[model samples]
Target: MSDDVSLMLRASRGDRKAFRSLVERHQQSVYNFFLRTTGHPEDAEDLTQQLFINLYRSAGRYKPTASFRTFMYRIASNLAVSFARSRHRRDGVSLDQMLDEGREPPRHRLHDDPAAGAEWSELEEAYLAALAELPADWRTAVELRVGRQLSYKEIAQVMGKSVSAVESILFRARERLAEKLEPFKE
Candidate 1:
Protein backbone atom coordinates (compact mmCIF):
# COMPACT_ATOMS: atom_id res chain seq x y z
CA MET A 1 0.00 0.00 0.00
CA SER A 2 1.63 3.21 -1.19
CA ASP A 3 -0.47 5.03 1.35
CA ASP A 4 1.27 3.06 4.06
CA VAL A 5 4.58 3.99 2.60
CA SER A 6 3.55 7.60 2.56
CA LEU A 7 2.47 7.41 6.14
CA MET A 8 5.71 5.76 7.03
CA LEU A 9 7.63 8.48 5.25
CA ARG A 10 5.68 11.09 7.09
CA ALA A 11 6.34 9.26 10.33
CA SER A 12 10.01 9.20 9.53
CA ARG A 13 9.87 12.95 9.45
CA GLY A 14 8.35 12.90 12.94
CA ASP A 15 4.73 13.17 11.94
CA ARG A 16 2.86 11.67 14.87
CA LYS A 17 -0.62 11.87 13.42
CA ALA A 18 0.48 10.14 10.27
CA PHE A 19 1.98 7.35 12.30
CA ARG A 20 -1.24 7.00 14.24
CA SER A 21 -3.18 6.79 11.02
CA LEU A 22 -0.92 4.08 9.73
CA VAL A 23 -1.26 2.09 12.91
CA GLU A 24 -5.05 2.44 12.87
CA ARG A 25 -5.22 1.11 9.34
CA HIS A 26 -3.16 -2.03 9.85
CA GLN A 27 -2.92 -2.84 13.56
CA GLN A 28 -5.69 -5.43 13.49
CA SER A 29 -4.21 -7.40 10.62
CA VAL A 30 -0.83 -7.27 12.26
CA TYR A 31 -2.39 -8.29 15.56
CA ASN A 32 -4.17 -11.17 13.90
CA PHE A 33 -0.94 -12.23 12.25
CA PHE A 34 0.76 -12.46 15.61
CA LEU A 35 -2.24 -13.98 17.37
CA ARG A 36 -2.76 -16.87 14.96
CA THR A 37 0.92 -17.50 14.56
CA THR A 38 1.70 -17.43 18.27
CA GLY A 39 -1.63 -18.85 19.55
CA HIS A 40 -1.67 -16.64 22.63
CA PRO A 41 -3.56 -13.40 22.91
CA GLU A 42 -1.29 -11.93 25.54
CA ASP A 43 1.81 -12.77 23.57
CA ALA A 44 0.20 -11.53 20.38
CA GLU A 45 -0.70 -8.22 21.96
CA ASP A 46 2.83 -7.76 23.21
CA LEU A 47 4.29 -8.68 19.88
CA THR A 48 1.96 -6.33 18.04
CA GLN A 49 2.99 -3.43 20.24
CA GLN A 50 6.62 -4.32 19.82
CA LEU A 51 6.27 -4.42 16.04
CA PHE A 52 4.84 -0.94 15.84
CA ILE A 53 7.53 0.43 18.08
CA ASN A 54 10.17 -1.33 16.06
CA LEU A 55 8.66 0.04 12.89
CA TYR A 56 8.52 3.50 14.34
CA ARG A 57 12.10 3.39 15.49
CA SER A 58 13.26 2.13 12.13
CA ALA A 59 11.13 4.54 10.18
CA GLY A 60 14.06 6.67 9.20
CA ARG A 61 15.88 3.73 7.76
CA TYR A 62 13.03 2.42 5.64
CA LYS A 63 13.35 2.47 1.91
CA PRO A 64 10.32 2.07 -0.27
CA THR A 65 12.19 -0.17 -2.70
CA ALA A 66 9.56 -2.82 -2.12
CA SER A 67 5.99 -3.11 -1.01
CA PHE A 68 5.65 -1.55 2.44
CA ARG A 69 3.47 -4.38 3.67
CA THR A 70 6.08 -6.88 2.60
CA PHE A 71 8.75 -4.95 4.42
CA MET A 72 6.61 -4.66 7.50
CA TYR A 73 5.77 -8.34 7.56
CA ARG A 74 9.37 -9.33 7.01
CA ILE A 75 10.11 -7.60 10.27
CA ALA A 76 7.11 -9.28 11.86
CA SER A 77 8.36 -12.67 10.67
CA ASN A 78 11.72 -12.02 12.26
CA LEU A 79 9.96 -11.19 15.52
CA ALA A 80 8.03 -14.46 15.32
CA VAL A 81 11.26 -16.36 14.89
CA SER A 82 12.78 -14.53 17.81
CA PHE A 83 9.73 -15.19 19.97
CA ALA A 84 9.86 -18.90 19.16
CA ARG A 85 13.55 -19.14 19.88
CA SER A 86 13.23 -17.26 23.14
CA ARG A 87 10.37 -19.48 24.22
CA HIS A 88 12.39 -22.53 23.34
CA ARG A 89 15.30 -21.27 25.35
CA ARG A 90 13.42 -19.96 28.35
CA ASP A 91 10.80 -22.65 29.09
CA GLY A 92 10.44 -25.35 26.46
CA VAL A 93 7.14 -23.82 25.43
CA SER A 94 7.44 -24.45 21.72
CA LEU A 95 5.35 -27.60 21.70
CA ASP A 96 2.54 -26.67 24.06
CA GLN A 97 1.30 -23.28 22.89
CA MET A 98 -2.29 -23.14 21.67
CA LEU A 99 -4.65 -20.92 19.68
CA ASP A 100 -7.52 -19.48 21.70
CA GLU A 101 -10.35 -17.23 20.54
CA GLY A 102 -8.35 -16.23 17.52
CA ARG A 103 -10.88 -18.04 15.40
CA GLU A 104 -14.47 -19.09 16.05
CA PRO A 105 -16.39 -22.18 15.05
CA PRO A 106 -19.81 -21.84 13.46
CA ARG A 107 -22.30 -21.01 16.24
CA HIS A 108 -25.46 -22.40 14.64
CA ARG A 109 -24.29 -25.95 14.14
CA LEU A 110 -22.28 -25.96 17.32
CA HIS A 111 -25.33 -25.06 19.43
CA ASP A 112 -27.64 -27.55 17.71
CA ASP A 113 -26.17 -30.47 19.65
CA PRO A 114 -24.35 -30.39 22.92
CA ALA A 115 -22.54 -33.56 21.89
CA ALA A 116 -21.62 -32.03 18.59
CA GLY A 117 -20.40 -28.89 20.31
CA ALA A 118 -18.15 -30.93 22.55
CA GLU A 119 -16.84 -32.84 19.56
CA TRP A 120 -16.27 -29.63 17.69
CA SER A 121 -14.38 -28.23 20.64
CA GLU A 122 -12.16 -31.29 20.69
CA LEU A 123 -11.55 -31.01 16.97
CA GLU A 124 -10.71 -27.35 17.24
CA GLU A 125 -8.36 -28.04 20.09
CA ALA A 126 -6.64 -30.74 18.13
CA TYR A 127 -6.23 -28.45 15.17
CA LEU A 128 -4.73 -25.71 17.33
CA ALA A 129 -2.45 -28.12 19.08
CA ALA A 130 -1.29 -29.47 15.77
CA LEU A 131 -0.70 -25.99 14.43
CA ALA A 132 1.28 -25.06 17.49
CA GLU A 133 3.47 -28.11 16.99
CA LEU A 134 4.52 -27.15 13.50
CA PRO A 135 8.02 -25.84 12.89
CA ALA A 136 8.24 -22.09 13.36
CA ASP A 137 9.05 -21.42 9.73
CA TRP A 138 6.22 -23.63 8.57
CA ARG A 139 3.85 -22.01 11.01
CA THR A 140 4.96 -18.59 9.86
CA ALA A 141 4.28 -19.52 6.26
CA VAL A 142 0.88 -20.88 7.11
CA GLU A 143 -0.09 -17.79 9.11
CA LEU A 144 1.14 -15.42 6.45
CA ARG A 145 -0.70 -17.26 3.73
CA VAL A 146 -3.89 -18.32 5.43
CA GLY A 147 -4.34 -15.78 8.18
CA ARG A 148 -3.02 -12.71 6.44
CA GLN A 149 -4.34 -13.80 3.04
CA LEU A 150 -1.03 -12.92 1.51
CA SER A 151 -0.29 -14.18 -1.96
CA TYR A 152 2.49 -16.67 -2.55
CA LYS A 153 4.69 -13.96 -3.97
CA GLU A 154 3.89 -11.71 -1.05
CA ILE A 155 4.69 -14.51 1.36
CA ALA A 156 7.95 -15.11 -0.45
CA GLN A 157 8.89 -11.49 -0.07
CA VAL A 158 7.82 -11.43 3.56
CA MET A 159 9.81 -14.55 4.35
CA GLY A 160 12.75 -13.61 2.14
CA LYS A 161 12.30 -16.80 0.13
CA SER A 162 11.62 -17.55 -3.48
CA VAL A 163 8.05 -17.95 -4.68
CA SER A 164 8.67 -21.62 -5.33
CA ALA A 165 9.97 -22.05 -1.82
CA VAL A 166 6.85 -20.42 -0.45
CA GLU A 167 4.72 -22.74 -2.58
CA SER A 168 6.66 -25.79 -1.42
CA ILE A 169 6.48 -24.76 2.21
CA LEU A 170 2.76 -24.08 1.99
CA PHE A 171 2.18 -27.38 0.20
CA ARG A 172 3.96 -29.35 2.86
CA ALA A 173 2.37 -27.33 5.59
CA ARG A 174 -1.13 -27.86 4.21
CA GLU A 175 -0.52 -31.58 3.80
CA ARG A 176 0.56 -31.70 7.41
CA LEU A 177 -2.45 -29.71 8.57
CA ALA A 178 -4.78 -31.97 6.62
CA GLU A 179 -3.21 -35.00 8.19
CA LYS A 180 -3.66 -33.54 11.62
CA LEU A 181 -7.31 -32.68 10.96
CA GLU A 182 -8.08 -35.86 9.01
CA PRO A 183 -9.72 -37.64 11.95
CA PHE A 184 -12.16 -34.79 12.35
CA LYS A 185 -13.18 -34.86 8.69
CA GLU A 186 -16.38 -36.82 9.11
Candidate 2:
Protein backbone atom coordinates (compact mmCIF):
# COMPACT_ATOMS: atom_id res chain seq x y z
CA MET A 1 0.00 0.00 0.00
CA SER A 2 1.05 3.57 -0.55
CA ASP A 3 2.12 6.02 2.16
CA ASP A 4 -1.09 8.02 1.65
CA VAL A 5 -3.13 4.89 2.06
CA SER A 6 -1.33 4.20 5.30
CA LEU A 7 -1.92 7.73 6.43
CA MET A 8 -5.60 7.39 5.60
CA LEU A 9 -5.75 4.10 7.48
CA ARG A 10 -4.23 5.80 10.49
CA ALA A 11 -6.68 8.65 10.08
CA SER A 12 -9.54 6.19 10.00
CA ARG A 13 -8.30 4.91 13.32
CA GLY A 14 -8.73 8.42 14.78
CA ASP A 15 -5.19 9.69 14.46
CA ARG A 16 -5.62 13.46 14.62
CA LYS A 17 -2.36 14.38 12.99
CA ALA A 18 -2.96 11.92 10.21
CA PHE A 19 -6.29 13.55 9.49
CA ARG A 20 -4.68 16.97 9.67
CA SER A 21 -2.10 15.94 7.14
CA LEU A 22 -4.84 14.80 4.76
CA VAL A 23 -6.64 18.08 5.14
CA GLU A 24 -3.50 20.12 4.65
CA ARG A 25 -2.72 18.21 1.49
CA HIS A 26 -6.21 18.21 -0.05
CA GLN A 27 -7.95 21.34 1.25
CA GLN A 28 -6.82 23.70 -1.49
CA SER A 29 -7.83 21.31 -4.26
CA VAL A 30 -11.17 20.69 -2.57
CA TYR A 31 -11.70 24.39 -1.96
CA ASN A 32 -10.99 25.19 -5.58
CA PHE A 33 -13.55 22.59 -6.58
CA PHE A 34 -16.21 24.19 -4.45
CA LEU A 35 -15.25 27.69 -5.54
CA ARG A 36 -15.47 26.79 -9.22
CA THR A 37 -18.68 24.79 -8.80
CA THR A 38 -20.45 27.50 -6.83
CA GLY A 39 -18.61 30.58 -8.13
CA HIS A 40 -18.66 32.01 -4.63
CA PRO A 41 -15.72 32.16 -2.31
CA GLU A 42 -17.93 32.44 0.78
CA ASP A 43 -20.08 29.43 -0.11
CA ALA A 44 -16.95 27.53 -1.08
CA GLU A 45 -15.45 28.32 2.31
CA ASP A 46 -18.55 27.02 4.08
CA LEU A 47 -18.79 23.94 1.87
CA THR A 48 -15.08 23.13 2.08
CA GLN A 49 -15.22 23.28 5.86
CA GLN A 50 -18.30 21.11 5.81
CA LEU A 51 -16.55 18.66 3.49
CA PHE A 52 -13.70 18.21 5.98
CA ILE A 53 -16.13 17.94 8.85
CA ASN A 54 -17.97 15.21 6.97
CA LEU A 55 -14.66 13.52 6.21
CA TYR A 56 -13.78 13.44 9.90
CA ARG A 57 -17.14 11.93 10.76
CA SER A 58 -16.91 9.43 7.95
CA ALA A 59 -13.44 8.10 8.66
CA GLY A 60 -14.74 4.85 10.06
CA ARG A 61 -16.25 4.01 6.70
CA TYR A 62 -13.11 4.73 4.71
CA LYS A 63 -12.05 2.08 2.25
CA PRO A 64 -8.82 1.75 0.28
CA THR A 65 -10.48 0.91 -3.01
CA ALA A 66 -9.81 4.33 -4.46
CA SER A 67 -7.27 7.09 -4.01
CA PHE A 68 -7.83 9.45 -1.08
CA ARG A 69 -8.40 12.40 -3.45
CA THR A 70 -11.21 10.59 -5.23
CA PHE A 71 -12.88 9.59 -1.99
CA MET A 72 -12.69 13.10 -0.54
CA TYR A 73 -14.02 14.69 -3.74
CA ARG A 74 -16.92 12.24 -3.86
CA ILE A 75 -17.86 13.42 -0.41
CA ALA A 76 -17.50 17.06 -1.41
CA SER A 77 -19.63 16.66 -4.54
CA ASN A 78 -22.36 14.89 -2.64
CA LEU A 79 -22.35 17.56 0.03
CA ALA A 80 -22.57 20.30 -2.57
CA VAL A 81 -25.51 18.62 -4.27
CA SER A 82 -27.34 18.05 -1.03
CA PHE A 83 -26.73 21.60 0.13
CA ALA A 84 -27.99 23.06 -3.15
CA ARG A 85 -31.08 20.88 -3.22
CA SER A 86 -32.03 21.60 0.37
CA ARG A 87 -31.51 25.32 -0.01
CA HIS A 88 -33.59 25.35 -3.17
CA ARG A 89 -36.44 23.40 -1.60
CA ARG A 90 -36.51 25.27 1.69
CA ASP A 91 -35.68 28.87 0.78
CA GLY A 92 -36.02 29.10 -3.02
CA VAL A 93 -32.61 30.74 -3.21
CA SER A 94 -30.85 29.52 -6.34
CA LEU A 95 -27.14 28.81 -6.21
CA ASP A 96 -26.66 31.66 -8.66
CA GLN A 97 -28.33 34.09 -6.27
CA MET A 98 -26.20 32.88 -3.42
CA LEU A 99 -23.11 33.29 -5.57
CA ASP A 100 -24.23 36.74 -6.60
CA GLU A 101 -24.53 37.68 -2.98
CA GLY A 102 -21.02 36.42 -2.40
CA ARG A 103 -19.48 38.36 -5.27
CA GLU A 104 -17.92 41.77 -4.88
CA PRO A 105 -19.36 44.49 -7.09
CA PRO A 106 -17.13 45.53 -9.92
CA ARG A 107 -15.01 48.58 -9.34
CA HIS A 108 -13.14 50.60 -11.91
CA ARG A 109 -9.45 49.94 -11.51
CA LEU A 110 -7.17 52.77 -12.47
CA HIS A 111 -5.08 51.38 -15.29
CA ASP A 112 -2.45 53.10 -17.34
CA ASP A 113 -3.64 51.08 -20.34
CA PRO A 114 -7.31 52.00 -20.46
CA ALA A 115 -8.18 50.11 -23.69
CA ALA A 116 -6.65 46.87 -22.49
CA GLY A 117 -8.41 47.17 -19.15
CA ALA A 118 -11.75 47.76 -20.89
CA GLU A 119 -11.27 44.70 -23.09
CA TRP A 120 -10.36 42.54 -20.11
CA SER A 121 -13.35 43.71 -18.12
CA GLU A 122 -15.67 42.98 -21.04
CA LEU A 123 -14.24 39.51 -21.48
CA GLU A 124 -14.52 38.77 -17.77
CA GLU A 125 -18.17 39.76 -17.64
CA ALA A 126 -18.98 37.80 -20.78
CA TYR A 127 -17.26 34.66 -19.53
CA LEU A 128 -18.88 34.77 -16.13
CA ALA A 129 -22.31 35.29 -17.63
CA ALA A 130 -21.81 32.46 -20.07
CA LEU A 131 -20.67 30.14 -17.31
CA ALA A 132 -23.74 31.01 -15.28
CA GLU A 133 -26.05 30.00 -18.11
CA LEU A 134 -24.87 26.40 -18.24
CA PRO A 135 -26.98 23.70 -16.58
CA ALA A 136 -25.73 22.80 -13.13
CA ASP A 137 -24.42 19.35 -13.96
CA TRP A 138 -22.70 20.54 -17.10
CA ARG A 139 -21.25 23.49 -15.22
CA THR A 140 -19.91 21.16 -12.54
CA ALA A 141 -18.26 18.97 -15.16
CA VAL A 142 -16.69 21.95 -16.90
CA GLU A 143 -15.41 23.32 -13.62
CA LEU A 144 -13.91 19.99 -12.63
CA ARG A 145 -12.44 19.36 -16.07
CA VAL A 146 -11.12 22.79 -17.00
CA GLY A 147 -10.93 24.81 -13.81
CA ARG A 148 -9.59 22.05 -11.57
CA GLN A 149 -7.79 20.22 -14.38
CA LEU A 150 -8.87 16.81 -13.12
CA SER A 151 -8.72 13.89 -15.52
CA TYR A 152 -11.94 12.40 -16.82
CA LYS A 153 -11.36 9.38 -14.59
CA GLU A 154 -10.80 11.48 -11.51
CA ILE A 155 -13.86 13.60 -12.34
CA ALA A 156 -15.92 10.47 -12.81
CA GLN A 157 -14.80 9.19 -9.43
CA VAL A 158 -15.64 12.49 -7.81
CA MET A 159 -19.04 12.64 -9.49
CA GLY A 160 -19.83 8.97 -8.96
CA LYS A 161 -20.18 8.53 -12.70
CA SER A 162 -18.25 6.76 -15.42
CA VAL A 163 -15.44 8.38 -17.38
CA SER A 164 -17.59 8.33 -20.52
CA ALA A 165 -20.33 10.11 -18.66
CA VAL A 166 -17.92 12.80 -17.56
CA GLU A 167 -16.72 13.24 -21.11
CA SER A 168 -20.27 13.63 -22.33
CA ILE A 169 -21.00 16.17 -19.66
CA LEU A 170 -17.92 18.21 -20.57
CA PHE A 171 -18.69 18.10 -24.26
CA ARG A 172 -22.25 19.30 -23.75
CA ALA A 173 -21.03 21.95 -21.34
CA ARG A 174 -18.55 23.30 -23.85
CA GLU A 175 -21.22 23.43 -26.52
CA ARG A 176 -23.55 25.36 -24.26
CA LEU A 177 -20.82 27.75 -23.27
CA ALA A 178 -20.01 28.33 -26.91
CA GLU A 179 -23.64 29.04 -27.69
CA LYS A 180 -23.90 31.44 -24.79
CA LEU A 181 -20.79 33.32 -25.81
CA GLU A 182 -21.51 33.50 -29.53
CA PRO A 183 -23.26 36.83 -29.26
CA PHE A 184 -20.48 38.41 -27.24
CA LYS A 185 -17.76 36.96 -29.42
CA GLU A 186 -19.28 38.40 -32.55
Candidate 3:
Protein backbone atom coordinates (compact mmCIF):
# COMPACT_ATOMS: atom_id res chain seq x y z
CA MET A 1 0.00 0.00 0.00
CA SER A 2 1.05 3.57 -0.52
CA ASP A 3 2.04 5.50 2.59
CA ASP A 4 -1.15 7.53 2.31
CA VAL A 5 -3.22 4.40 2.00
CA SER A 6 -1.44 2.88 4.94
CA LEU A 7 -2.01 5.97 6.99
CA MET A 8 -5.69 5.95 6.17
CA LEU A 9 -5.99 2.26 6.97
CA ARG A 10 -4.35 2.91 10.31
CA ALA A 11 -6.65 5.86 10.80
CA SER A 12 -9.63 3.58 10.33
CA ARG A 13 -8.45 1.66 13.39
CA GLY A 14 -8.64 4.93 15.44
CA ASP A 15 -5.05 6.00 15.06
CA ARG A 16 -5.20 9.72 15.61
CA LYS A 17 -1.53 10.18 14.84
CA ALA A 18 -1.91 8.38 11.55
CA PHE A 19 -4.85 10.59 10.68
CA ARG A 20 -2.92 13.70 11.60
CA SER A 21 -0.09 12.53 9.41
CA LEU A 22 -2.50 12.03 6.55
CA VAL A 23 -3.99 15.49 7.17
CA GLU A 24 -0.58 17.10 7.21
CA ARG A 25 0.40 15.30 4.05
CA HIS A 26 -2.65 16.29 2.05
CA GLN A 27 -4.04 19.49 3.56
CA GLN A 28 -2.16 21.95 1.36
CA SER A 29 -3.25 20.21 -1.83
CA VAL A 30 -6.84 20.22 -0.65
CA TYR A 31 -6.59 23.86 0.35
CA ASN A 32 -5.16 24.78 -3.04
CA PHE A 33 -7.97 22.85 -4.73
CA PHE A 34 -10.57 24.86 -2.83
CA LEU A 35 -8.77 28.15 -3.40
CA ARG A 36 -8.58 27.53 -7.14
CA THR A 37 -12.18 26.48 -7.42
CA THR A 38 -13.72 29.05 -5.06
CA GLY A 39 -11.34 32.02 -5.58
CA HIS A 40 -11.75 32.97 -1.93
CA PRO A 41 -8.97 32.33 0.59
CA GLU A 42 -11.21 32.48 3.68
CA ASP A 43 -13.72 30.13 2.10
CA ALA A 44 -10.90 27.88 1.01
CA GLU A 45 -9.60 27.61 4.59
CA ASP A 46 -13.08 26.82 5.91
CA LEU A 47 -13.69 24.24 3.21
CA THR A 48 -10.30 22.66 3.82
CA GLN A 49 -11.06 22.30 7.56
CA GLN A 50 -14.49 20.93 6.77
CA LEU A 51 -13.00 18.42 4.34
CA PHE A 52 -10.58 17.06 6.94
CA ILE A 53 -13.34 16.91 9.54
CA ASN A 54 -15.50 14.92 7.14
CA LEU A 55 -12.60 12.63 6.32
CA TYR A 56 -11.94 11.97 10.00
CA ARG A 57 -15.58 11.20 10.64
CA SER A 58 -15.75 8.84 7.70
CA ALA A 59 -12.33 7.22 7.89
CA GLY A 60 -13.81 3.98 9.19
CA ARG A 61 -15.71 3.68 5.93
CA TYR A 62 -12.81 4.43 3.59
CA LYS A 63 -12.03 1.63 1.20
CA PRO A 64 -8.81 1.40 -0.77
CA THR A 65 -10.63 0.86 -4.05
CA ALA A 66 -8.89 3.91 -5.55
CA SER A 67 -5.94 6.17 -4.83
CA PHE A 68 -6.16 8.29 -1.70
CA ARG A 69 -6.26 11.48 -3.78
CA THR A 70 -9.15 10.19 -5.86
CA PHE A 71 -11.09 9.42 -2.70
CA MET A 72 -10.25 12.74 -1.09
CA TYR A 73 -11.22 14.68 -4.19
CA ARG A 74 -14.43 12.72 -4.59
CA ILE A 75 -15.35 13.95 -1.15
CA ALA A 76 -14.10 17.40 -2.05
CA SER A 77 -16.25 17.53 -5.17
CA ASN A 78 -19.37 16.63 -3.21
CA LEU A 79 -18.56 19.18 -0.52
CA ALA A 80 -18.00 21.92 -3.08
CA VAL A 81 -21.45 21.37 -4.53
CA SER A 82 -23.07 21.34 -1.12
CA PHE A 83 -21.21 24.46 -0.05
CA ALA A 84 -22.15 26.32 -3.21
CA ARG A 85 -25.81 25.38 -2.84
CA SER A 86 -25.91 26.43 0.79
CA ARG A 87 -24.05 29.66 0.14
CA HIS A 88 -26.40 30.49 -2.69
CA ARG A 89 -29.46 29.81 -0.57
CA ARG A 90 -28.14 31.81 2.34
CA ASP A 91 -26.65 34.74 0.41
CA GLY A 92 -29.05 34.79 -2.53
CA VAL A 93 -26.23 35.37 -5.02
CA SER A 94 -26.84 33.45 -8.20
CA LEU A 95 -23.90 31.60 -9.71
CA ASP A 96 -23.79 33.97 -12.67
CA GLN A 97 -23.59 36.98 -10.42
CA MET A 98 -20.95 35.38 -8.28
CA LEU A 99 -18.80 34.55 -11.27
CA ASP A 100 -19.22 37.83 -13.09
CA GLU A 101 -19.76 40.61 -10.60
CA GLY A 102 -17.63 42.32 -7.97
CA ARG A 103 -15.35 39.47 -6.98
CA GLU A 104 -11.83 39.27 -8.53
CA PRO A 105 -10.65 35.87 -9.61
CA PRO A 106 -7.68 34.26 -7.87
CA ARG A 107 -4.70 35.74 -9.73
CA HIS A 108 -2.18 33.67 -11.55
CA ARG A 109 0.67 35.38 -13.34
CA LEU A 110 0.55 35.43 -17.10
CA HIS A 111 4.18 36.41 -17.46
CA ASP A 112 7.24 35.62 -15.39
CA ASP A 113 8.55 39.17 -15.12
CA PRO A 114 7.24 41.29 -12.25
CA ALA A 115 7.23 44.31 -14.53
CA ALA A 116 5.49 42.69 -17.48
CA GLY A 117 3.36 45.83 -17.66
CA ALA A 118 -0.28 46.79 -18.10
CA GLU A 119 -0.65 44.65 -21.21
CA TRP A 120 0.17 41.50 -19.22
CA SER A 121 -2.17 42.53 -16.44
CA GLU A 122 -5.01 43.04 -18.89
CA LEU A 123 -4.35 39.66 -20.45
CA GLU A 124 -4.25 38.02 -17.06
CA GLU A 125 -7.52 39.59 -16.08
CA ALA A 126 -9.09 38.52 -19.36
CA TYR A 127 -7.90 34.98 -18.88
CA LEU A 128 -9.26 34.77 -15.35
CA ALA A 129 -12.51 36.35 -16.46
CA ALA A 130 -12.88 33.80 -19.22
CA LEU A 131 -12.14 31.04 -16.75
CA ALA A 132 -14.77 32.29 -14.36
CA GLU A 133 -17.33 32.23 -17.16
CA LEU A 134 -17.22 28.47 -17.37
CA PRO A 135 -19.90 26.37 -15.65
CA ALA A 136 -18.82 25.28 -12.19
CA ASP A 137 -18.63 21.60 -13.02
CA TRP A 138 -16.79 22.28 -16.25
CA ARG A 139 -14.49 24.64 -14.40
CA THR A 140 -13.82 21.98 -11.80
CA ALA A 141 -13.08 19.42 -14.49
CA VAL A 142 -10.68 21.78 -16.22
CA GLU A 143 -8.98 22.56 -12.94
CA LEU A 144 -8.52 18.88 -12.26
CA ARG A 145 -7.21 18.15 -15.72
CA VAL A 146 -5.02 21.21 -16.29
CA GLY A 147 -4.39 22.82 -12.93
CA ARG A 148 -3.99 19.64 -10.88
CA GLN A 149 -2.62 17.51 -13.74
CA LEU A 150 -4.96 14.57 -13.24
CA SER A 151 -5.57 12.01 -15.93
CA TYR A 152 -8.99 11.84 -17.51
CA LYS A 153 -9.70 8.57 -15.67
CA GLU A 154 -8.68 10.10 -12.36
CA ILE A 155 -10.84 13.14 -13.07
CA ALA A 156 -13.71 10.77 -13.82
CA GLN A 157 -13.15 9.13 -10.44
CA VAL A 158 -13.07 12.44 -8.61
CA MET A 159 -16.07 13.81 -10.52
CA GLY A 160 -18.14 10.61 -10.38
CA LYS A 161 -18.37 10.60 -14.18
CA SER A 162 -17.09 8.45 -16.99
CA VAL A 163 -13.76 9.24 -18.58
CA SER A 164 -15.47 10.25 -21.77
CA ALA A 165 -17.70 12.59 -19.81
CA VAL A 166 -14.62 14.28 -18.46
CA GLU A 167 -13.17 14.50 -21.95
CA SER A 168 -16.31 16.12 -23.25
CA ILE A 169 -16.47 18.58 -20.38
CA LEU A 170 -12.86 19.58 -20.88
CA PHE A 171 -13.24 19.82 -24.63
CA ARG A 172 -16.19 22.12 -24.28
CA ALA A 173 -14.50 24.16 -21.62
CA ARG A 174 -11.45 24.65 -23.80
CA GLU A 175 -13.56 25.67 -26.77
CA ARG A 176 -15.42 28.22 -24.69
CA LEU A 177 -12.20 29.58 -23.25
CA ALA A 178 -10.67 29.89 -26.66
CA GLU A 179 -13.67 31.79 -27.94
CA LYS A 180 -13.67 34.06 -24.94
CA LEU A 181 -9.98 34.77 -25.30
CA GLU A 182 -9.86 35.15 -29.06
CA PRO A 183 -9.86 38.90 -28.96
CA PHE A 184 -6.55 38.92 -27.15
CA LYS A 185 -4.81 36.89 -29.83
CA GLU A 186 -2.12 38.86 -31.68
Per-model TM-score on C-alpha atoms:
0.80, 0.76, 0.80
Give candidate 1 regions above 4 Å deviation: 89-121
Model 2: ten consecutive residues of lowest lDDT: 103-112
What would the C-alpha RMSD of candidate 1 be, to one decimal place?
6.6
Model 1 per-residue lDDT tens digits across residues 1-186 = 588888999999999999999889989999988876776767888999999999999999999777888888999999998898788532233322322333432322213246664655656766765677678889999999888888999998888899999999889988987886775567
The lDDT, on a scale of 0 to 1, for candidate 2 is 0.71
Q: 94, model 1: CA deviation in Å? A: 10
Find the candidate with the highest lDDT and give its number. Answer: 1
**Alpha-carbon lDDT of model 1:** 0.79
* Model 2, position 161: C-alpha lDDT score: 91
What is candidate 2's lDDT per residue for 1-186, written digit by digit as tens?
877677888988989898898888888888877766665667778999999989988888888887776777788878766765565322234434534577422322323356754666544655655665556667677877787777899988889898999888888887876764565453
lDDT of 3 by residue, 3-112 (tens): 99999999989999999999999888888777666656677789999999989888888898768888888888887766765764223343345446755443443333
Q: Is candidate 1 or candidate 2 better by lDDT?
A: 1
Model 2 has a clash total of 0
- By lDDT: ranked, best first: 1, 3, 2
RMSD of 3: 5.1
